[model samples]
Target: MSAADTTTPTKVPLPRQAPPPTAPITPPGRRTSGGATVPWALLAPCLLILALVLGYPLVRLVTLSFQEFGQSQLWGFKPAESVGFDNFAEVLGDGEFWAVVVRTVVFAAACVLFTMVVGMLVALLLQRVSGWVKTLINIALVASWGMPIIVATTVFKWLFDSDYGIFNALLSKLPGVDMIGHNWFASGPEGLAVITLLVVWGAVPFVVITLSAGLTQVPKELEEAARLDGAGAWGVFRYVTLPILKPIVVMLTTLSVIWDMGVFPQVFVMRNGHPEAEFQLLTTYSYDKAFVVNDYAQGSAIALLTVVLLLGVIGVYMRQMLKIGEVE
Candidate 1:
């Protein structure tokens, strides 16, 4: 080739540029779905089950609260006759219902406060203990919780029984005691006290476990630093430990309130709605209205009211939880 031809670049056909590789088509079965869509599809069954089991009943309950039973329809369906707000008016106006509600709120509040304080104290003690003692304490508390509620109720009832109660027997041994066999569940306030004691006994272990877990999350360094700064044990706990534990404490308190408010078996077995329903909390009241008196309408109304109260309590709790860091 001439120098000029050699210097010139060879006219080799440029390699054809290949089209950008396309994504492999997912087979109808093998294709992965969108992030949001797949979750919703998988959740469909659970949502359906929740609606059927929880949603429908709650809706039915609210509906029943607004209706009264009437003659069965020709199709054999007994549609409730709407009574507008009569049920609400009746429930609100009933002195007994309001009394029970007030008692429930007070009892639940007492239970939550006492249980949280006692449980935190117990947890602090447990943290100070060592090895086998810690294990033993845990086992004992867990065992108490594992006992069946009915069994616990029966045992407590016997402990507080009018004739054969150990509590009265112990009282008899005290100096100058006149009444040895006081009936714990004879009056409204007294019965509520007994119920509150039983509920606190059953619930404290859970608080202990939860609070102890929260305590573990508190940094040892922070505690040591607080101590070096001349902060006393109480001061450290008040400022450092408690602030960290606020969320867990709030959660436990909320749960305890919810649990104690709905308590039934302890009061039921202790008194059986005795002394003219003196010991009837909302749960027992609803049960008695539904089954004993066959007043399903009243029962449904009670249930719906109880639900509203609980929801309100939960809303307050959530608000408190949200406001935890605001003060600090």
Candidate 2:
């Protein structure tokens, strides 16, 4: 005891410091009362920019839809007179308008169907192909996708030219299938079909890329398990793959509907910027009303209606996405 006490000094305990100030812990999937405001604060600048850029135009469009805005008013010779829903009534009552609506819906549906099927097939092919082959196909798709709309339309026009077109040339080679001098744009149905093809061609690239990325995320174990459970190729795809791919498919279909319904440049340029009455979709109809007839109010009304339809589609898409997220 004497030796130990001499060698070692008496120990003294240091006082513990209080814990540093910290934020209150939030449970997973829950936020603090103030957390909701944080995101809004960060988004404020972007919201402001969007309001500045789009708000005024949208307001003007709505106003125009409810007024009688014409060339005279546009030139400042007269003020726009309020017409209430007259423009909407006129558009809604027009038999041609209804016809155009039906045609537009069918065209968009066909385009969406073809685009999804072809895009999915190509995505599956990409998964099975050699690396270099897939790379080449991707390059081709990107090249087509990156092509200017006007340029692509013009190219398609040339390809279907009645006087000298490779399409007719190629078809003529088929035994007894004389397609020489066949005018693809002579009829509305034929012309719209060609336009559909063009649209599908341009749209497939994005669909392929998106689906390919999604396919990578699918669990291989589930696929193997399905196969082991006596699922054939089609059975596995129908039972396993399709369920997982539903969200992407729905999103793509909605977007395609919006785009295909709003198809203007392809139809316009294909017909030399003067699409025939038979060729008119909602976008072209609006343009024709506003510029060709100098009826800006009616044009705005049609455009507003188109926007409503698109909003409906978007709402459905958002609802489906939320449901998918909830399921996940």
* TM-score against native, each model: 0.83, 0.89
- Model 2: residues with Cα > 4 Å off, grouped in runs: 1-38
lDDT of 2 by residue, 227-248 (tens): 9999999998899998999998
lDDT tens per residue, model 1, 1-328: 7788768576989899999999988778664756668889999999999999999899988887788843242234866678988988988899999988887788888998899999999999988999899999999999999999889988888888888899889888889884567987667777677778888889989999998999999999999999999999999999999989989988888888889889888877776544356677899888887767766777889999999989998999989977876776
**Runs off by more than 4 Å, candidate 1:** 1-33, 37-46, 70-79, 273-275, 325-328
Q: What is the lDDT of candidate 2?
A: 0.93
> How many clashes show up per model?
0, 0
**Would you list the C-alpha lDDT of every candidate in the order shown?**
0.84, 0.93
